[model samples]
Target: MAGKRSGSPDPKRHLWVLGLIAPMSALLPSQLVLYTKLEVFWWIGPIIVLIVIPVLDWVVGEDGTNPRDEDYELLSKDRYYRWCTYMFLPVQLSGLIIAAYMWSGDALSVVDKLGLAATLGFVSGIGINAAHELGHRVEHLERWLSKIALAQSAYGHFFVEHNKGHHARVATPEDPASARMGESLWEFLPRSVIGGFRSAIHIERERLKRKGHRWFSVHNHILQAWAMTAVLFGALLAIYGLRILPYLVLQAVIGAALLETVNYVEHYGLLRRRRPNGGWARCSPRDSWNSDRLVTNIFLFHLQRHSDHHANPGRRYQTLRTSEEAPQLPAGYATMIVLALFPPLWRIIMDPRLLEHYAGDVSQANIQPRKRERILAAYEYRAAA
Candidate 1:
């Protein structure tokens, strides 16, 4: 176990409350619009996530502090930290209902509805982060909550694949979710979405077969999860009618895109080496990127301490630690997410940093197959020199 920091009280003790900001952010724009009668507030969700949080991350700066080893049990057992994530579901669902009502009533202009959908998209995307935290736990309720949270984005299969598949093959060439060098986020997004779903189905099918259950049985976790999405969307459509269909689809796409963007950043160009036995080496802290930026750390529930989370998958979010061995992102996920949308800009900022991480060895990093030759031609000479 890593040594704990020497602080008397956890500095982020109260700031953990800010974790609620993303889900609450969805409600805020509506309340603000009510108060100010400005249609612009409908766009506040993206503004808060993409703009305000990045600025706050820069201003608040990094928080590399870790909890005392003894404090882990106390913090993890705390109901307060659990509620911080649990509360997100209600607020998230409420925001969708509120948005649906608005969309159905024709109260919002087309542009205003688009803004509302974008805002909800952020809430749904951030909800995936919350689901990621809960899905890793052993408790059945937490696992089910994870699936329910994903219902909004229609990405419940993530619960199955992420825990069983992505974690198993992360940073390896076979993992679609792990971005490679020379592959743009635009190129990686659809690949991950489709690949992850197919992988989840295969995993669930085998699991059910081993347990003597049919793959189509309700006990199949992947089917159970997708069923939740179907029910949620069905109820919403029954009440809201087809007018909100476009908004729902738009928000779902944006939400999925946001989740995949973070996936691209988390393990971009990092690779796990093969062992003497021909099996891939066990995952270590360095396989995942780490960031200690305070604002994002709170919003993401210590997800920026990803190296620790990946190393200890069973650890609760409140107790996840940071490791100096992990490669660090130059900024928080929010900042990196913006950079990821532009392929050239993302490569310019991250490619050199990745090479530097591997001590100038381009082969040590994962490279996209189609661009492998071109990438090596460009960097291998400099690496050799």
Candidate 2:
């Protein structure tokens, strides 16, 4: 497929979108409170969002732009995304505060309270999400915001690894973060989490060696991240006491799970074939997922524009555009994540398409497969290799 042509970004549109961040962040705690109180309503948020949003988008349909313009330049060094990053600090902090309150109140049931805390924790993932965008930038303020965002999630090394490692080597077997074709979500999660962290350590170590410093020193982001996580956990313990420790851990786990779920969806079944020279093709927007669903796009700060992100890592979230040349998920990211929870269904739905796409390229002789068995065999060989 041909790549989509996008128009230059519009700053006004970016500001309009950035305006929504505060309200969304503010509303999340209240929504969690309601969910905790009602108990039954917890499922409602995911249901309504996962099901209804896509149906509505399908009915309304997207503008038929080959590569939909995201207007990334609008926020690309502009103050709008910076302002959003600044605004996000309070929003995430409020979530931590609310978790503390719930832990202290002792009025709510364990499940309900944990649910609320988990929701907030998931919201905290937005910190990493935002950082994922800003860390790619060259500016000092943006880089700082990126670190702050990652620090908030207790996943600070991602700021270094994602830009230095993942982007540089995505869609290749060498990249621990990339999901291989036909790999189940269950299989990918542990590998990605463990491998991603190790990659970060490796990247930081290389940087330290280059600078003639010890890898374990304060300058290393991995050690810094551990210290930051310790401080966060200490604060949680202080505010909520021992009773809330498990809940906080669970909340972080759930948030991490949510992040992994997103990773699964973003690059599920995508692959970069090896060239004759033993190098994978250069990463393209086509190697990642793409969605134009406006609602979740707004909530994710346009992260659904995965192709644009891979193509231009330094671009602010406000500007990530949609590209037609990129492979698209059949539905919005939220819905796709829900589907990914079912491994059989996910494989059945995705494997055939991937096989077809990979095999269709005649120029890529190594990717050719005469039949489905051949495709499966090829993957199995690669996995073992």
Clashing pairs in 2: 9-71, 72-319
| Clashing pairs in model 1, backbone N/Cα/C closer than 3 A | none
In candidate 1, how many Å is residue 61 off? Answer: 0.3
lDDT of 2: 0.65
Q: Residue-wise lDDT of candidate 1 within 25-104, one digit each (tens)?
A: 77787679889998888998789888999999999999888887877777778788888899889989998998888888
Candidate 2 runs further than 4 Å off: 1-37, 41-75, 359-385
TM-scores for every predicted model: 0.95, 0.82
**Deviating ranges (above 4 Å) for candidate 1:** 1-9, 381-385
Question: What are the per-model numbers of colliding residue pairs?
Answer: 0, 2
Query: Which candidate has the top score in lDDT?
Result: 1
